[model samples]
Target chain A: MTMIQIRDVNKRYDDGFHALKNINLEFRQGEMTVLIGPSGCGKSTTMRLVNRLVSPTSGTVEIGGRDIRSIDPVELRRSIGYVIQSVGLFPHMTIGRNVAVVPRLKRWDADKTARRVDELLDMVGLKPDLYRDRYPSELSGGQQQRVGVVRALAADPDIILMDEPFSALDPLSREQLQEDVARLQQELHKTIVFVTHDMDEALKIADRIVLMKDGEVVQSDTPDRMLRRPANDFVRTFIGQKRLEAGGAADVAEREAGPDLGGFVMADGPTVNDVMVTQPAVTYPGRGLAEAITTMERRKVDSLYVVDRQRKLLGSVSIYNVMDSYGDEDKTVADVMMPVRYSVQSGTPLTQAVELLASHRLHNVAVIDEDSRFIGLITRGSVVRHLAEKLPHGDNGEEPGSSTGLGPQGGNREEHS
Target chain B: MSAGLSFFEFLGERLPDLLLALREHLTLSLIAVLIGSAISLPLGVLLVYSRIGWLNSAVFFLANLLQTIPSLALLAILIPLMGIGARPAVLALLLYSIMPVLRNTYEGFRSVDPHVLEAARGLGYSAAQRLLRVQLPLAVPYIMSGIRLTTVYVISWATLATLVGAGGLGQLIVSGMGVNQPYLIVAGALGAIALALAADLLLGWLESALGRRFGLRGGAAA
Candidate 1:
């Protein structure tokens, strides 16, 4: 069913800037339709029309077969969730209060509002007990955006408008959040109109991709169809030749070789920096053996990298080495640590890193920057998980830790130290 | 040495008169600031939302004009209209108080982050709701500073009220100058200074307390 229909909509600003030109589009229920284009292409303007943030100068926007102008704009907006690139989490409000904004506006009782706030926070992986009372400034950029997303979903609106929501995030967090949105959409089935400039992001999460240019949509098609059969040269150029060719080849290979072989079709695969776990278990070399063991125990890792104050990787310390020196209270991590035998540069290809890990029988390899600063670690689990995410069916029931010597402990160890 | 001793003796004798003058000064300053705030706050808010550009400029022009007028000259002008006593005195102080409060309130509302306002609108906040819930709370620091400045201005200007026979601390200074009594002028000047300091201190405390509640620190720039 068509949830929103923009019929021949044209938008001209008061300054006489024609922002949208006779654009017509329909957003289906339970499908994410991404409006993608270069800057000032009116993709954001088109999304705003659905929520009445931008009123059309000519023609009408209809929600559920009724003209949007007929309804009060404030009331209409309340029924449609909106998230922006800046995240716009009210700095003054606590995380819980921020998430409860729509619910409170709709006049939900305190009990229900509180429960919904907690539920939404938990849904986005923020523990309500820990984050509820904290202010937005206390959170990192990615965490604040997570709050922004949950705040939009607080009222459980059937329609959501996302205006370049994840573009400001780092590449790793951006990918993680893209996956989160995809997973949430699968579960909630909301009609989402997402506007972004990056075609890769649109292709990753959008069920339908609407390519726009100069205030007009060039093509509106499924991600697969748009990649395989671009409507025009502009669409082809915008989607990029590399992605187009890779996507087309992947489609054919998926049909012929089935889902398991789908991960290898892309010749321009991810680099180490794209797939490596950025926050790995690490400790200072000056720390005593007892402290090193404590750090490993707290991080839930069998081994940790020992770095100096500048985060220059010096060596690695296994739990066994710490246990062996447990009797000697005077011994430090510098004494028991083994020299770093294997490492890769930050932008080294994942295929090469995978080959090194497989050939050397190493559990994980350190990823270093130009200055030899310990930036990330590519464990066997990270490689397997990255490959699993690439498959059409993302959750392939393949244990990321099954083949690694260190078991599940060698997966991803977030740095809290 | 004798003059200083005699000054203390004089203060003892004129204690009731000094107290009466202090009360008058406090009353005049309070009434002018209260009425000034009553007029300027809503006007400032109106200016923030008003689409008529000339109207905003005209209001600011009038306020700037008022501020440029000498306090004694303003009182002299007001006497013919309001005619003596506390009324003319308060009218002058009220005019003087308008510019600071009005400018601050306007700036406070205008300084609210546009992105936050956009989010509020996107989340379904009505115009009034956005003003009251988001803009107003965020503008509290700037507004408080404005009120503090207005209060100090009014209190200091109230000392000049005695020229119109309003009989505040200015009466003591004027009479002492007429009679060549230095201690009288000192006592009246000290009283006015004390009142201004006290009012500033109290308002400063209130501003910081409100600032903390609103998630601002050290109040916003005046």
Candidate 2:
């Protein structure tokens, strides 16, 4: 069902400045649609017009098939929730009173108002016992924004309009609230028209993202489709961050590990424990190749343990770590060490193990078991030799990232190309 | 010091008149304030919302214009038209009372955050509902504070009301001033000052108590 329909809506300010021009959009019931754009792009104006905060200069705004102008403004307001960037909590009122303001204005009884206030506080992960009595001024920006959302949620409107509600919060707080709001949307299935300038924020919470620019929509599509196949260069750049670690994700993902690694690795159930080094030589993920190269040279070890904070090896480096030393071994580990997300459990299939290394371009992968206890290791030299003896690379360019093993049957080498 | 009277006689002789005068003083103060707040509350909201757009500037201009009058002259001006008694006294107190109430009311409503107004409008509240629910409630502290200060000013000035033949503690001081009785003058003066102090304490207590109970910010800050 179409919860809100905006047909050629235009908003021209009193000064004759047109903020939105001939816009057409529809928000479906129980789905979350995010509007994202650069500043002055009319996304915000579009949001304000839905509730008649700013009336359309022409065309119609319809909620549930009827013209919004025809509904009594008060009745229409009680049925829609709005949360804003500033949170806009009435500092004079306690959280409970703030939440109850709309219902009380709708003339709800005291008993019902009290119950609804508490319910909303709880729904927003705030304990009514503690938060209900506190004034807005006492809460942090994030807490106040949540209270703001609850206030909008108070009357249980079928549609919610949020305008950069979490923009003022710190990164961690914003992420947490994003998670909370995403969970809420999943559970409640309320039709949401959310507006934000941040693309990452839009991606995190929106089921469908409307990429807008200069008072017009450039593209509107499902988040996955938009990410996987951006319509244009603007979209590709806008949605670029999700694939922020782009080229490497396909190289590192278990499914996209190329075939060369599979041809060389040991085929027998040679678990990571049997061959993995407990302490080949340790190095910080930082310090580029300097520490690892020194550890390799000084300790006279072929490879160094690139264990993370937990002392679990990420991947090992040998000639690869030294190969870069001639250029600048002093570079930070984050700059040089291959970005790896794969760590296999011991006793895994040789094919599965081969997939992990080729995708990430790791010379070797640490092995663990069911309990994630470190067990052993596997190498590209061994895995590729194994794959070359197994199957030919029929589909070469279809690198889907998650595919374990897909590469030309050739010798494995540490090279960017 | 009266040439023949002792301190006890001084106290005893003036006590009854002063008490009666105090009663009248308190009465004038309350009546002026109650009326002042009633007028100023809506006046304040309009002063803000109108923004010089809808209504003529006359009403707002009058409120600004009243603030400039001297309280004594206002009482004298009202005396001839309203008669010399509580009516004239109350009228003068009302004039004095408006400056603080009107100014505070206007300020309180004007100070309401624009973001809040937008949020309320976005939530589907009509202009009227936003004013009542969002703006007015948020402005309550400033409004109460305006009236609170106005109350003190009204009561303090009501002592001057006795000059117009309105019975209040000022009557003792006026009569004492007429007879050159220093003790009586001091006594009446102290009584009015004490009443003002007591009023401040009482109003301060009431503002906080109500703010706590109904989610209002207390006083001018509320």
Candidate 3:
């Protein structure tokens, strides 16, 4: 059953501007639909119309097959959850009360409301006991956003409208919140209408994406279809062809290799990140060389990536480097570690990564996120394994001339590292 | 000059009368402020939500117009209508208090964060719910500051009621001026000033307490 149906909707402001042209769309039950475009593209206006915050100038909007204009708007909104980018928690209320606003308005008893507040907070990974009594000012930006999401979810509304809820957060926080949203959709199966201008965010979160431009939807399709076939030049630029190409190439590879390859296709091609080890042995910069050696020994690795508590990449120390500093009583790992100059983000293509590693004669490159936090590492071995897996029928298993460019001794030494 | 009494001796002798006048002055000031607040706060809320700029401007214009008249002039103007007593005196102070309280309430409503208001609206808040749950709580700091300012002004202006035989501390000044007793005049002037200062300090504490409850940093400072 369709959760929301908008037919022939047109909105014109009193200032003689058409905010939305004749739009006809249907939102399916239990799906995440993202409305995305640049500013003034009517995404938010469309969302507002569904909640009856703004009535359409012409045409009709129906929620659950009932005309929204016919129903009381306040009652209609009570059954719909709404979240925004600003995370507008009432400063005067405690976190618990902020989450319980709608429940209280709906006249739920105090005991039930309190229980629901705690349950929702715990679901979002915030400890209810520690956070419920605190004010909004006491929370970090991300924590407040978590509370905002839980507040919207408090009433267990079947439909939710989110307008760029994570846009105000830092990249890491935004990514985490995006994951939380994805998890919520998976677990609850609620009908969600999300509006954002970020194409990547739409691709990551949307079950179906509605690409808009200048108050008109250019195309509406699944993420895979949108990436494969853009309806127009505007959408093509909006999705950024380079990113599509990267995703498209991997997808094509997936198709040709059949479903047998399945998850391995993403790892075998496209980005160097495809072949990276996400949980490489990590040590802090202030540790003693003895400690670094022990960590490497425990992890069964020759080198340890050094990072601060925030996971900021400092450098790395290999077994050979630590051995060179043997018998040093007071020397910390920072004293023995080689400065890490070669690192790659997860988006770097496999070919570029291979060239970088070959040119620099490096055994590995640390993978860091935009914030320079160590995420993983792409090694010479993983790249070789991915290449080996990509070959159609190279099952002869002749060792593939270990180290494609390095000599025999060089190959063995690289293998040892 | 012929009266051989020191300032301390005069204060000691006139302390009881001075206390009675202070009590009268305080009663009149408090009553005016309480009544002014009761009238202005709701009016301010209505003006803010009315969404008619012209009506809001007209209301503000009339309130401000009343404020521009001198307090003595207002008292003189009210005497004929209310007839020389605490009614005329309290009514004049009430008119003077309206400007600060009403203006502050309007400003407080206007100054509420638009984003927070939008969030409240989006989350299914009815008009009354939004006003009570979000707007009023957030605007309390600004509103309290306005009430504090009004209370201080009312206390200061209450002394002027002596002109109409209302019998506040201002009577000492009037009688001293007539009889040429400088100590009586100084005692009455200082007492009125002290009352105003004391009301301000007390209201300031109340404002900050309200602010602290609402997590606002500058409630008392305003």
Candidate 4:
């Protein structure tokens, strides 16, 4: 069901800046719709209209089939939650008090408000006992934004509006918060209108992505559809071709091959562990050069990872390194082994790991667990084989600019040449 | 040494009169500040929320004009209206006190982070609620500083009330000059100075207490 319908809305500021040009949109219940564009494209303006933060100049916004203008703006706003890029946690307010603001405004009982504040904080992974009494300044940037999210959820509003809420955070914090919102939406099922300039963020969390440009929406589609069949050249370019191919590959492959290929459909993008070689060739560091060379030959590998008794990766001994030290009778694998340079954490997205490999021109990168203990290895062969199995026919040539592995400019192409 | 002893002797002899002057001086300064704050605070808040640009300009212009008037000149101007004594003195001090308190209150509200106000509005706080709950608490430091400034100004200015027959500590200095008694002049000057310092210290303590309670530094400075 459509929870919010913005019908033919137009907004022109007093200074004669026409911010929105006859926008029409519907936000479905229990779905997140992201409004994205370059700066000044009116995405923020459109989102603001739903909350009556910026009212339409000409058209009407309806909430649950009733005109929003008919309700007092303050009352209407109290029924919805809002978050902004700055986090905007009241510095003077404790985390508990900040989260209780909406409840207090709605005149929820003191005990109920306190319990809700604690529940909301705990929901966001912030311990109520540790963080409830702390002010926004006392928390780190990520923690503050978590508080901001909980504050929005305080009153249990059925709708939430987020305007670039995580944009001010560092990249790691931003990604974590994005996942948090996606997870929260799964449980809460709130109708969410999120506005941002980042396409990756839009794709990561949005059930529906609205691409806007200069006061107009260029396209509105599911992330899969947007990636596979871009509405126009503007969208194709805006969502770069590399991302399109990577994101759409699995879906397009599944569609062509039908239900039998369902087992290989990675609805979420593949992670490093999905394609990593769990049991790569290993050699003890104290082993002689001949022994390491024998291990590499037996495994049909060019290198062997040297490890201690605990299976913690010490370094790698390559065939060439073995040859260089073959004449030294006393030399062990440790004496000639090169330090492992490129490694990724276990759950990292495959595309990022692949980019790391392509950018640095590495044959393989080690995958480590949280303890920094080696778990597996993601090699070029593993990735190519995974793609071949998923794509099946190697018929990705239909897409105008599609290139396998990394892209035309990637080091993977250099290896082919 | 003899001069110092005589001054002490004079203070001992005139203790009741000195105490009376101190009481009158304290009363005049305190009353002016209290009334001045009651008027200026709301007016400042009104100026902040008022959409009329010229009204804000006119109010600030009148305040600035009032401040520029020489203290004795303002008393003289008020004489015809209030007719001398404590009434005219207080009216003059009240006028002087308005500028600092009003300006600070206006600045306090204005300097509140726009993002915080936006968050408050988005969370469904009414305009009045935003003022009382968010903006006012965050602006406590600035408002306290304004009151402190006004208190000090009113205290020092109240000494001049004796000019209009108000008979504060200033009368001791004026009468001592008539009798060629330097101890009397020193004593009156010292009393006014002590009161100003005491008031300033007390207000400074109050400002920090409010600042800590409201988390003012965290919000305003951060």
Candidate 5:
């Protein structure tokens, strides 16, 4: 269902600057539509037009099939949730009161408003009892932003307009909040129209990305389609494919494996978990050199990572070193094995994992959990395969099969070469 | 002294007259401030939001000019039109006190954080609602400061009412000076000073109380 419909919108400011030129768009219910562009690209102006913050110079904005201008602007805004870059939590009001503003304005009963405030604060991961009476100044930036989101959602408004809500936060807080928003959207499925200039943010959270430039939309498509099939040079340059390839490959590849992964892309780069091969060839420390070499040959890997009976990593014995003691049945693999210094946590981002491998000039690294138990191995070949799948070959020529089988392979790693 | 008494003796002897005069003096100041606040506050609010920039400036200029006129001269000037009594004296003081209340009211409403105002507007507050809930509350400190200044100024200047035949503490001073009685003059001067100080302290307390109620930074600075 169409939640918001903007038709033939044109906005000309008092200074004669054209802020929006014939914008025509429809935002669907239960989907997060992100309006993204460089500064002064009319994305903000477009968002403002929906809520009547800036009435279009010559067009109509409709929500739920009724023209927005026909409704009282004040009433329209009261029923539509709004969040800004500043978070805009009323500094003078306590968190509970701030979240209860709309409810109070709507004349809700005291008990109901109190219950709703608590419900919203809890929904956003803030303990209501702890944060309810605190002022906005008392909370940190991330906490304030969380309250800001809850305040917007307090009234259960059908359409929410967010204007760079997380831009002011630190990178770590921003990532965590982006996840929170994604998670919240999954549970609530409210129609959200978000305005942001950060491409990665748009790609992470948007169900449909509306790319704008110079007061007009250049392209509006899913993130996968936008990445693979840019409409023009402007969009291609704006997305910066070359810049992405140089440093943002893991981020691109992480999403590449699941184009339809709905909300925020979790990892900044692909994690070791994303590329690691579970059930890597292993040999017991008590095994002979020939026995270890035979297992390596069967798995077609160059080395055998030796483990104790509990599967904790002890060391690794490569085929090259095992050959020196080929005929010695008395010598166990542990005697020939070299201590493995290069290991990464399963959650370590693939970029850092690659760095560790490259610096040590190693072909593979053991993937371990916090308990030092070996789970898998991340190989250079797997990294290359993941990245190659994201590279644009031509317009709309995406290899749809490449990542189809990559989805949560379920307790076993099948050889796909 | 004319009555054959010391300054303290004169104060004791004229205690009844002094009390009557002090009451009249306070009555005149309070009436003038009340009238001035009632008239100027709404006008100040209207002027700030109104688009008639020239009219606002002209009204402000006239009030500023009124404030600069010598208080006695203005009371004297009003004497002919309104008769020489408390009526003309109150009128003059009202004119004198208008500017501070008006100017500060304008400044208070104007100085409300634009972002806060924007948030209010965006959240669908009507013009009246915004003024009453957001602007008025935030402007309390400034408005109270303005009223405090006006009250103190009016109380001190009420002595000039004697020139218009409106008897106050100034009667003793005028009569004492006429007969060259220094003690009576000292008594009157002290009474007026004490009244001014008392009024100032009282208004200051009110201002801070209002500030604290509105949560405007504990109200001390304002």
Candidate 6:
């Protein structure tokens, strides 16, 4: 079913801010689409338009084939589940009562209200017996967010709007909540429009990521394609900006690849990210051990980049982690993979082969610089030998440092702290 | 003048030694104000919470009617039935004090969130339960304001009972003025002011404490 469709939706505030211009997009049923952009982007305003919290200055918003303008706003809002950073809980009501709000307003009978509240709390992993009667003030931030989600789910709405629902939480809590949302999506299957300024967050939960800026959409595509290629330079700039610190690069991998990355990024020259698959797609550590074996067979590639949702490159999964974590359901992605090694720069001299092998125990390193934005990889067997035959090893032929700038020692660290 | 302290002493001595007269005056003030508040609180809640046309109209009518009449004039109209003494005085005080309490009470209840009430509505609370469970608890601050205003008015009007032969502090003022003793008249006036001020402070404290207890629903704004 076409859950929501926007065609040339342009909103210009009376104050003369072009909040959104010529917006066109379609959201299908039971899919998770993330809208991401910089701070002043119209993503938040766009989501608010769906619920009519903020009306479009000049555009038609249709929900399930009905122009939202024709339907009563109160009724429309009631039919859709809305969640924001604050959660907007009624402070006076009990946890159970809050979750039961929409259903009760819609007049779900007594026994049914009780049953729905009970099931929802449980689905969100909050035991009804422990939390149903407690007040919003009594819960923690993550728990409050969970209840907020439960409240939206109470009516079993076909569409859900979530705006930075986890940004306020700590990293561990955010990961936990994201997992909860992923679990919920699998079970209830609501068509969700999630908004966030963080690209890593978009990669984690989005089936399709829609990049927005200045109230206009720049690109919309799946995580795999977005990483493999980017539609434009602005997206490419955001594609690999560090998040959590120099941890493992799992999350950054998805981000490092742009929305345009469906094919390979060939660095023979400077090609825009949209034209090629710049970097290889990284698999998650927790994915079945069978993933490594299957990807190897399907893509006919010997290795796959391993990453977390942030798009940071954790490390590459070769025949290595598959053999190690094989039969170990208990084994995580981090457990079997080596820390990042065999990395290089995009501009290493075509020489120094003998020195490269002796210094870094790896066959290759990247031939790139600090930004790592468009660095080309250099194989020890290729570039070093070429450079050795021609230039002198002294002051010039590629700065004497390891081919992989930081060396195979610690090349690609985590983006976030 | 003993900073005007002697005025009080002089008036206290001049008033009659009749214990029954003083007690009757105080009793009349209490009875009238109490009855008035009892009727107003419920009526105010209904007007604000239920949005019932008759209830709101009744509140508006009583408040406007009482404010228009002079206190002494209103009492005269009741003089035919209860024959002077405490009866007419009590009726006059009750009628005069109702408007403020009624208006504030109604406002307090009406201002609560429709969403909070919707939660109650969703929970399947009966009409009466919705009022008791949601509106009343949140309306306490406004209700308290009405109560405070009624207390201040009733205390001042207690002396008006003297005109009906109920014999309160006003009896001393009347006697002192006739004999040319300004001290007795001043004393009675000072006592009424002190009583009103005290009632106002006590109720204000009570309302604050009540607000603290029910502050969970964005209470500072309440």
Q: What's model 5's lDDT at A263?
A: 24
List the global CA lDDT of all models.
0.82, 0.70, 0.80, 0.81, 0.78, 0.66
Rank candidates, DockQ, best first.
3, 1, 4, 2, 5, 6
Candidate 2: chain B TM-score against the reference chain B: 0.86
Q: Is the docking of candidate 2 incorrect, acceptable, medium or high quality?
A: acceptable
Predicted candidate 4 versus true structure: per-residue lDDT over A283-334, tens digit per residue: 8988998887676544445577778888787888777778888999999998
lDDT of 6 by residue, A1-417 (tens): 788998678888889989999999998899999999988899988887888777787768898888999987677777888777766566656889878878877888989999999999999889999998888889998999899888888888899999888887755456678889988999889999999876656766888889998888998988545644567667665554422222214433543454533222221222211111234435677767676667654433344566666555566666555676688867655666666654444333333422454465544443324543323333322222122211222223233334344221111211110
**Model 2 agreement with the true structure over A1-417: per-residue lDDT tens digits:** 888999988778789887887888888999999999878998988887777777888999998899989987767777888899998877667888889878877889999999999888888789999998898888888888888888888888898989988888755357668888988888889999999987656766787888887788888887655654566767655543222221223323332254434522333333443333333345667655655556554443345545566665555455454566547645655455553456777656655666566666555666666755444445443343223222233133332322655332111222221
Q: Per model, state how many residue pairs clash.
A: 0, 43, 0, 0, 0, 60
Interface RMSD of each: 1.0, 2.2, 1.1, 0.9, 1.5, 6.7
TM-scores, each model vs. reference: 0.74, 0.71, 0.75, 0.75, 0.75, 0.55
Q: Is candidate 1 or candidate 2 better by lDDT?
A: 1
Worst 10-residue lDDT window, candidate 4 chain A: A408-417
Candidate 5 Cα misplacement greater than 4 A, ranges: A241-417, B1-6, B219-222
TM-score of 5: 0.75
Between prediction 2 and prediction 5, which has the larger DockQ? 2
What lDDT score goes with residue B115 in model 1? Answer: 80
State residue B51's C-alpha deviation in candidate 5, in Å. 1.9
Give the residue spans of candidate 1 off by over 4 A: A241-417, B1-9, B219-221
Per-residue lDDT for A405 in model 4?
A: 44
Please give, for residues B1-222, the per-residue lDDT of candidate 4 as tens digits.
245567678789889999999999999999899999999999999999999989999999999999999998888888888797899998889999999999999999898889999999999999889999999988788788899999998888888899998989999899889988888889899999999999999998888888788765533521
DockQ of each: 0.67, 0.37, 0.67, 0.59, 0.31, 0.08
